[model samples]
Target: MKKFDVLTPIGLVVGVVMLIFGIVTNGGITGFFSFIDPASLLIVLGGVIAGLLINFPVKDMKHIFTVIKQGFSQNEQNLDQLIKTFVTLSERARREGLLALEVEIEKVKDPFIRKGVLLAVDGIEPDMINDIMSAEITAMEERHRKGRNILEKAGEYAPAWGMIGTLIGLVLMLKNLNDPSSLGPNMAVALLTTLYGTLFANLVCLPLASKLALKTDQEVFLKQIIIEGVIGVQAGQNPKLLEEKLSAFLSSKERQKAAELITSGEALNDEA
Candidate 1:
């Protein structure tokens, strides 16, 4: 399941607030108007968009919004609950044989887990199952990399385009050096472009790319655990031993929690 990730939006809002506060503290509320340059924004944002269009195919670019949306949401995978589920499945398979798991597999919500369990029930060889699932993981990684690359490139281009805008502003300012009154406004344009570019890159693109990368790593890790559990169930491993095996994937704190659950007999009752 996926849920709204409040941290991303909250972080963005806090950053803007901090910038506004800094400006207000230094030069009053009127200072905020000095930083708002429509021309500078156009240069930075337009240049970034053009660069992305040139860098990626139209079809791929169409999914850019979807990719960004992912950073605002997070998969809710409870490792402890997942381990308990596999242990329960292992116990059932051992008691009644692999074919008996078909009904239980239907109740599983995760397509990855359902596919793995179905393959095991179909009597596929363990090696073949691992090979198939591992290939899918590799494909998923490739797709994620493509999506993340767009954001990364946007981050890279933002600063460069900002510098370009600054150069343009400098040329115009230098052309009318005799006009002392015009220098301040021109200099503001030059400096604001760089500021806009840096802010967009650091605050938005790069952070989102990092978030997507972290999410990808987490998903791959969970899938690996699923692969292990599915194979163990197929092999008819001892339920207690299988639980211990899956528990190895958990952190020290989570391992302790799982141990406590088992010690109190809550895990078995929950499975039952």
Candidate 2:
């Protein structure tokens, strides 16, 4: 919670820096302003935004709001800790009564995961647990899908917007056909907006959509492991078996750490 992590928008920062360097290295800074095209910028922005709203619903737009904010969010949602903690909780609940986990659940920062755990420990049947958790999963997926769609829509829109920008510039240029001296600068502004649009679509929006999609899949998988572990815990399996089962959620490095923890604990027990 203390101020840390990468909050700066890397895409915007890198773009600005490269633009500045290119301007200086090519023809100098004045050349940049000499070719500035406000109309081109407006076309790209307005067209993209209009296109996105056309493609997705208002609800989806709400999801996109969160995705946009997450672009600047610095907190790295670490899953390794969540896996380790949940497994430890499952094992503890087996050794002690389910009520023993009440305190731990209170401490969980993730409300949904914690709620699922509590529901299981309260002796909900496996089927009922699945129904509740599955509903939650469906809702989460819907929410996530909307955000991804918005980003994808933005990606699709950007290039078309660029083309539109170029067309508008070209039309104006052609209208002044006798002014050959005006053609080069007009074309540069026209083409630059297209370049900006295409690059933004391909290099930025598409990549972000892919990243968000991957993150959504990963989190869903993690929650799936949680669902299984919670159901397993509710059924009251052997704590060691429960630990082994939940360990599947962790990466290989985490799997190794879990193994060492179990081994060291066993060794201490043997010595005692």
Best lDDT among the predictions, by candidate number: 1
The lDDT values for all models are: 0.90, 0.71
Candidate 2 lDDT over 1-272, as tens digits, reads 21232423676578767877887778787867754677667777788888877777776676676786554443344444554555566667777878887876776666666788789768888899988998888898887777777878889888888987788778878987899998886787679779778877877788777766776776677678778867776777775677677777677887776666655443111110
After superposition, which runs of candidate 2 have C-alpha atoms over 4 Å from their true positions? 1-8, 74-80, 259-272
Model 1 lDDT vs. the true structure? 0.90
- The number of the candidate with the highest TM-score is 1
Question: Residue 240 CA error for candidate 2 (Å)?
Answer: 2.1
lDDT of 1 by residue, 1-272 (tens): 88899999999999999999999899887988899999899999999999999999988899999999999999986777777778778888988999889987766678889899999999999999999999999999999999999999999999999999899889889997999988887888799999999999999999999999999999999999999999999999997898899899889998887766655544322321
Error of 2 at 239 (Å): 2.2
Candidate 1 contains a number of clashing pairs equal to 0
Candidate 1 — which residues are off by over 4 angstroms? 260-272
Count backbone overlaps in model 2. Answer: 0
Error of 1 at 26 (Å): 0.4
